[model samples]
Target: MDLALTAAGASVRAAAALSPRWGAAVALPLFGHVAPPRPVRVDDEPTMWRARRGRLRIPGIDRRGTEVETYEWGSGGRTVVLAHGWDARASQFAPLVRELVAEGHRVVAFDAPAHGASVGRRTYLVDWLDIFSALQERFGSFEAVVGHSFGGLAALVGVAGGIGAQRVVTVAAPADADALLTQFQAGLGYSDAVSVRMRELFASRYFPGERDPFAWLSSVRRPIPAAVPLLIVHDRGDRLVPFAEAERIAAAHPGARILETSGLGHNRILAADVVLDAVLEHIAAPIAAPAAESSAQVADREVVAAA
Candidate 1:
């Protein structure tokens, strides 16, 4: 049995090295082995059904004549916006929304284009940011923004670009687009060159006339206005996004707090009590005053320091 297991592992590694898609194939089974068991969707859950409901309409960022669907619960006071990970709908945050509503906070969540009830055949970062901006505008400034996985990265970009959230929390978030692309390349057994080609292909197919979709991250990490507090929660056991990405985000942003845990993995972190508690604490904390200088000034300093 031991020999067989070893041989199987070797075969998987060989497959990963041979084909880019094989990496995902190999990683999926490992993820199932380590990740916590939970349903990915919770919209139909009884607790989520009890919360108040509202609909939102917002224009797409890059696409013309396109609108996105948004859902809101609770009142406008002390609003919290929740963004779910890739391939997940707004209902995926049902558990968190129920708890937040019980605490007297309003919650707004949306189905990313092509996910849940939202319209579109494909989804991308710009679309996610547009939805975030629209929600911030409609619901008033968000007291807190909590996002999971890819959604977490989107939240950071949106908040950095003036989404009006007082506090930000990311669960198992990749620090930047480059990190995410690297992960994909490693997982898919693709060289850096192939990864670049894949990104070009994705952008061309997804955005058409766009120069590059991946370059958006360069603009995202600019010094955030000092008023917003950022919190990142990641599980060391996560197989999809490495925990080191969270550390990088903390290192990049001054005063960003990172809470690292074990056993939660990627999706399971959503329902992890400890992760949820950290998020609640961060949101409940008092807001910091906006920075005396502009974020661009701070970002320039960061660049110089790195150089």
Candidate 2:
């Protein structure tokens, strides 16, 4: 979140936090920075689930030394990055994080720039990509990258930028960035002029290259780097992001698979047993190996071939 942008946004955000009525203004200039991340909520896990928690400071990105909050679990070679949705903290993934660790994966999750225990009180959807890029630089290649909602969209941005990843998973991700903007406008009851100016401002802040973020939302036409196994998960009952969005993502990526669950709404999908099982199996599934043969079997096979 860039506090240097506008005072109206900051003041409105502060007011919005106190009263939900002001939340309609979230779309104006400070859409992403409208709210601070909710405080860390610890889950009731076994004592063994202790995480190596800390902050990562990048000199260039955060001039004020705003090291972002980060948490890690497991020490296995296979690393999986977990990205939670908009306005949510990294610890929200505690349930999934434990499961991933138990499945023998080194898991890393973080609160985005201004969220969670990180510095600052503002954030933007575009900054999510930057966070992933910074983490990828420090962590190297990931075995799998998992994202939900807005975070899922950021995962797409990372993939487009060639962040090293073996597999990608998105849960209830938006199909188009333009759609997000429209939703924001409608949510705030803002006019077309506001939407247009906001787009210009957003472009300047994040996509200065004149690149289209909406296109990037579904950017798998060429399958970003030719190919990367993708899993798109969504629930038909989700009210926040529709199930059709997942279908569109699947359609964009030729081989991308879509898994639709039931009754898990938008947020509850993270806790559903079926969703957890699917994600675990996808990332933890091993490559097939040739069957080992005993000397007697080898001899028998050789004899049979000779005969």
Maximum-lDDT candidate: 2
- For model 2, what is the C-alpha lDDT against the true structure? 0.68
lDDT of 2 by residue, 85-149 (tens): 87777777777887987878899988777677677766665566666777787788889889999
RMSD per prediction, one decimal? 8.2, 11.8
| Candidate 2 Cα errors over 4 Å, as ranges | 1-28, 41-49, 58-65, 209-213, 217-223, 286-307
Q: Give the CA lDDT, 0 to 100, for residue 31 in model 1.
A: 21
Per-residue lDDT of 5-79 in model 1, one digit per residue for the tens? 455456555665777456335533332121122343444567555645555555554456466566677774899
- CA lDDT, every model vs. true structure: 0.67, 0.68
Best by TM-score: 2
Query: What local lDDT score does residue 98 receive in model 1, on the 0 to 100 scale?
Result: 72
